[model samples]
Target: MNLLEAFKQTKFQLSGHGNRNIKVLKDAFEQMDEQQESDMYGSGKIIEEFQDKLASYLGKESAVFFPSGTMAQQIALRIWCDRKGLKKVAYHPLSHLEIHEEDGLKKIHHIEPVLLADKNSVIELEDIVGMDEDVSCILLELPQREIGGQLPSYETLESISTYCREKGIKLHLDGARLYEITPYYKKTAAEISSLFDSVYVSFYKGIGGIAGAILAGEKDFIEESKSWKRRYGGDLISLYPYIVSADYYFDKRSQNMDEYYEGAKTLARLFNECEGISTLPLEPVSNMFHVHFNHSKEKMEQILIQLYEETGIGLTHYLNKTGEHSCYYEVSVGDRLAAIPIEELRNVFNLLNEEIKK
Candidate 1:
């Protein structure tokens, strides 16, 4: 693709729902008026107030706000490692900490991860049951991203939590998309969060903030994390942009999670019926899933090029790995793409199949 055309190449986009900037501004203005519009860092009260609200919302004794999810999570690990007097954390092979994060847990936190689940599968309790008692904490991602947002059965989650309690191991939730899982489990965020010792929620994922994360746990745990946050350079001078935007998006999208669930199921169903397109998890358990392309990457790129040149849809973030004959692919459904009618998605797939047939 030429430079100009390359810049315009977008066939489908993932997670486009939380773009209500006007609403966000309105909320910010309202909060400013109530609080006299003091600077964010001048008092550190803004972040503390936000933490209090978040802690109560997550059912934790306290919460700490950070500039980034990565830093927040690593700090959690450091704390767990210190508490248990163990250096290892049990997590899924596809866990964000394992595949992503640039090995920050190892280099920064000085901890090791015991891969708990087989690659390409949701984590199971059995995976960690046989581990030595020295395991510091168990990290659970509610919707396994690489596995098409698959989650372990609630029974299994309960079993795992029970085991953690029995073994006296810490349970930490990588709840970046925790809010999105509530509808799937038919549970409330507080209900689900109560099962874990500590929960980390992202403000930018489903919440559509500029960028921020909240780590919630017992008062002591959260207080300790603040020290780690400062040490890890996560303490920001002003988190108001992230905080204000997060608060707005939380209020706006908390009511629409069910709608997102419906959209995810619909898109997965439509993709299943399309020729040469397949999805992992068969059914979407969250607002994201993977779509496999049953054509060579060269052919798929050609189709993507054509689709973008002719239409404005943005699909597939990176190269797919479906199978030998067809390139594999995955699609994440979120805000902008979800707003489009179901018929539009079906039509796109229809055109894709027709082009492949040609």
Candidate 2:
């Protein structure tokens, strides 16, 4: 079973978007504008406002909204490859393009992936220096997920951008969790985005939008992307629900993202003080971090379930297998995390460790 979303009852889930109640959507509609024009093929006041807002926020010439990040990125990269007349794109080995997309970028678009640096490591400026192929674009995930939300230093990012610009290789950011790291890096969305040729931010992940992504880039690039959207069946007749929800959350949750980052740092510190457990990066660079344990998956699962049943503190929904005798789980602090006392959470981790040892 997929452990990511499997839980009987969780007082405070460690990761994922808000499992919003049905009324949340109802409330958004109640507050929505009645005079707004409904988007037809991405041409309505509602869609245009959302797109323009994202474009300004990201410091890009234009922006387009997509039904999903998968569609947004696929088309964005396709446009890059087409303009450059190259079939190859570059990204980390474990990025969504490699693992989750199932080669949709390759199978459908026929764009090859030049797995950069290493399979399980962040791509560095030096990594691109030694590349033998002139690729179309380099896709980067801000605070690279699947690796504990680690972010490269701003200096390194700037250097990489300079190098990419010199080499004429377009840079794309898969900033699904961009807002989460904004506070950590001390940079606004546009400041960080200025380094990339194209940037994609998700509405649902960090922002708690209903479901969608905003792809931003130059006007011409975005114009080309719109055509791909129509071809890929992403240009829905009406996307007001996604638009309004994203607009609402972008204003609501984004304000507290920095608080979430601080909470993650505090949580990581407390966990590391315990024996037989540690957080990857030792310090969280974003709102998410990996809690590594020296125990079997079965043992951890049992303890997680037992603890949730007895204490009503759902520290984690599932543990990810890292090795034969090691596992890791992500802890993402949300508004619910603010309700529970930090001391109580620490106690749960301590007890979990003690139980696992036995």
lDDT of each: 0.77, 0.84
Question: What TM-score would each prediction reach against the true structure?
Answer: 0.89, 0.94
Give the Å error, residue 30, model 2: 3.4
For each of the candidates, the C-alpha root-mean-square deviation to the true structure, in angstroms, is: 3.1, 2.2
Question: What residue pairs clash in candidate 2, if any at all?
Answer: none
Tens-digit lDDT string for candidate 1 (215-324): 99998998899888778766667677777777777877777778777777887787788777787778888777777777777777777667655555655534564566
Q: For candidate 2, which ten residues in a row score worst on lDDT?
A: 1-10
Task: Encode model 2's per-residue lDDT on 19-59: one tens digit a residue.
Answer: 66776577567877688678888997889988998999999
Cα deviation of 185, candidate 2, in Å: 1.3
Off by over 4 Å in 1: 2-15, 18-45, 321-324
Best model per TM-score = 2
